[model samples]
Target: MAQHDDDRRFSLRHLLGLVSRFARMAAFGALASVAHAQDAVSTPAGPSIALFYGANPPIDELARFDVVVVEPDARFDPRAHPKTHPAWFAYVSVGEVNPHRSYFSAMPRTWLPGVNEAWASHVVDQTAPEWPAFFVDKVIAPLWKKGYRGFFLDTLDSYQLIAKTDTARAAQEAGMIRVIRAIKSRYPKARLIFNRGFEILPQVHDLAYVVAFESLYRGWDASKQAYTEVPQADRDWLLGKAATIREQYRLPVLSIDYCDPADTACGPATAARIASDGIVPYVTDGDLATVGVGPAGQP
Candidate 1:
């Protein structure tokens, strides 16, 4: 009788211990639920951008929107101005380097495929393993520390030429992914915006939050004049790229194109096509800064 009583007591104690362990796990799962609830990005108003130091739109005007894209070298002091603007994306060209940029010195001759005389953006050698890190460390970190929200990766189309349609494409893409992931690891809150670079959509389409489609109708000439053409084939090609991003990534796109600034546009069909595409069209001379904001900075 004594032995049976002892066994019964032991069994009861073991059952209680199991119950305690189960309760602890349930509490832990509840806490994890709370942590996961906090991870979503805050929804804000529409996106806006300024060129040449936000001169086209006063900082105040630019601030009216949720996100503002700016030049990499543009002067900005987030603490100095209003605090509430949700996101500010700084522009950086990863595929190429402008000769005037500080990093141009680190560029090697081996990296230079050639130059686009029209845009004047130097084609850098993305084949270099260290090039992407240099951009993230030098350009991206500084902007994020300065309170810029994310990055506007511009002139990425230049990558198509820098890398031959062989091993270079994959290599260039891997390098860019490394660069973007590095930025996100440090500032996980910052959004990644890719401009052009449509060829690599399969790789980076899902990586970016917003994308800007370029060279729709009026591409700029060396003289900065609006060289206009419908080029239905080109328009269709770009739309196809947009379709890929939307289908693959489900990210919002901000399509940008050049048109005549004055009241006269080269063709009415051009204006209609831009509107139909459901992208933000900036109908101006190639220069975005001039017509966007007046001297007083009224929109």
Candidate 2:
């Protein structure tokens, strides 16, 4: 009887030990899984390859990109819900008025004295008191409500067109600074990207998240319908300026080089040259209907 009782007690002890060991292993495994999940969430993804100035692609196709720039009234096929999607910015231009619109009905007394023949767009007088308010109310507010996370703020360089004298140029730049500051104040969390606003970059660098240069390496030849390399001197000057903005302001530089879609070499070469300067490159058609990849397979 004594022996049987001792045997029973030993078996009970062994079962308890097995249960404790299994519980500890399960707990450790769960903790390791949680740690791995957190690490995956924290790791930053690669820089986004983006498209601009075109109708929105299919939602699944659009999801593949990291950023997109579209007109205020541009339509989306499936209706992009960017707020719930992976991090991306939808940008709208702020400084130039689209020439396609009826100017008189859109805004009274806002257009600058001349039309930009090259783009068929009217430059806005940034100094006009009502200009910023009109933009915020009519453009920025509507887009923000539609779930856009950024502003492209094109035509910051348009000030260069009207500023014939040093004093006039300085005033134009100051006006740009004021408008940018106002946008920043209103939408503190929104991403602000200035397009080729090199002269005004130093003044508004703190307020901007990115600076983009269009046609840095290649541009469309309307006569030949082909891509042409920019002059070496021009390329050197722009690259130098881009480097300064990147290093000094700690801002990322984005380069948009337009190329003839049929020229396979142009896309890869331009993207490589732009990337060599430590700028994110996007090679697209003049109308930006398609996205091109770099030689290194970067988007």
Candidate 3:
């Protein structure tokens, strides 16, 4: 009887030991899985950017980009649902009013300084109080109703081109700030991508979803009416400025370099070079009329 009792006790101890070992193993496995998940959440995939102003780009291709900017009114197939794409942004020029825009007919004549001969667009007087109201109620609300969740605010500083003096530039800067604040207050959740709003970046850096600058490697020379390589000095300045902006603001920076659409090698080569600097790159033609190099490094 004593021997049997001793045997039973030993069997119970072994079973308990086995159970404790499995429990420890399971706990460790769970911890490892959590650590891997945390790492994945912290380190996101590389960013991709695309800009297509032309009509009816391939929907499947547009969907591949992490973000895309397009002309909202450019007729697209209703089935594309591009207006509802989470990152598809409508292009909005804050500092210039193009005659082709729907609101141009209603734009006040006093708001214009003169035509930006390069693009045949009228520069806006950002200092005008009416402009912000027009932008919020007339320009942006219509697009919001159409389902756009974001705006690519281009030409944010085009007023600088005609400001002509330090005082005038300061006033324009203040005006831009007011407009940005109004937009943010109206739609706090809307994603805003600013195109080279460097002058006012410090005040509104946190408001930006992304900061983009054009012509890091190649660009359109309005004077020559053709594509041209960016000067070395200009490239260096822009690269350093971009790095500073990225580090200081902790904002994602995107570089849009113009290249000949027909040149197959230009797209990938420019993208690779720009990517080397830890910046997201999108190489496209000057007109931005066709899809070009995207995140995949090729068109």
Candidate 4:
């Protein structure tokens, strides 16, 4: 009878122990849920970006964004902006040169082998050793002196349009990489934002501050000379590239979708669509002079 009593007591104690353990686990899980909810509430928002290729806009308006890309002007001073001074980036075309550029007159004729008739800018032979030096010293240094520490490097792979063969394209790609490395070496603190340098992204992703691409949903069709919907094939290709950039490299992405500046519905709707893909979206006209709708659908 004593043995029977002891066995009963052991079973009762074992059941109570299990109940206690389960209760502890349940309480721990509940606490974790509460912590996660708090974290969701308190986490800071991502960078809000704006791009304006024109000269100075209202500093108060530009200060609204976290990052702003503008055309380099000798007169524009970032320090004069509001307390929430946006990180200003100067627009620099790496794969092409415009006739209006101060250094354009000095470019060797051989370096201007191709012309982008759409924008009336000449495609540069980035492979030339002289090009990177000229660019760093002549083009970028003067802007740096003007207190512009950030650069929006555009048309990085536009040389591919004129590259005759795979080998030629690879050489151009290598040259572009050299230019990027040179920039980083020269100014380690400069924020470099690349505009669709997808070919060389893997090589320079670590050096970049942000990877920006255009035409996710809508953009100016150069061939058609109209603002049109981005074809599905092209859209899918860009979407895949963006996803890999975000998922694999863990980099922030910005996408520009061109819409009529006057089309309020299109601007907000397109911005919303691009934002849905976890990218910062700026829907503006091709000129990019007007401040348009942002990811929040705010103008």
Best by TM-score: 4
User: Which residue pairs come into collision in candidate 4?
Assistant: none
What are the lDDT figures for the candidates, one per model?
0.63, 0.70, 0.83, 0.83
Tens digits of lDDT, candidate 2, 95-137: 5666554333577654565466677766677777777766676
The sequence of per-residue lDDT tens digits that candidate 1 reaches over residues 1-299 is: 99999999999999999999999999999988866553211111125433333443456655655566666465665645547563666778777777888878866777777786767778866656776677777887777778777788877767676566768787777766676666777777878778876666676566677877666765655464645654789878877876666556676555555555563544234434554554434333566554332111123
Counting clashing residue pairs in each candidate, in order, gives 1, 0, 0, 0
Summarize candidate 3's per-residue lDDT along 139-212 as a digit string, tens digits: 88888777777899999879977899999999999999999988888999999999999999989999998889
Off by over 4 Å in 2: 1-46, 77-79, 83-91, 101-104, 221-226, 294-299
Give TM-scores for every candidate, taking all chains together and pairing residue i with residue i. 0.70, 0.76, 0.81, 0.83
What are the runs in model 4 whose C-alpha is more than 4 Å off? Answer: 1-46, 73-75, 82-84, 222-225
lDDT of 4 at 218: 94
Residue runs of model 3 more than 4 Å from their true location after superposition: 1-46, 77-86, 297-299
| Residue pair clashes in candidate 3 | none
User: Per-residue alpha-carbon lDDT of model 4 for 1-299, expressed as tens digits?
Assistant: 99999999999999999999999999999999988876543331357788887666656776677788888753576656535568877889999999998889999989988999888999999899888788898878888877788999999879987898999999999999999988888888998889999999889899988888999999987777689889999999998998888878878788888998777789988887787677888888888888867756245
Q: What range of 10 consecutive residues in model 2 has the weakest lDDT sum?
A: 40-49
User: What local lDDT score does residue 170 receive in model 1, on the 0 to 100 scale?
Assistant: 76
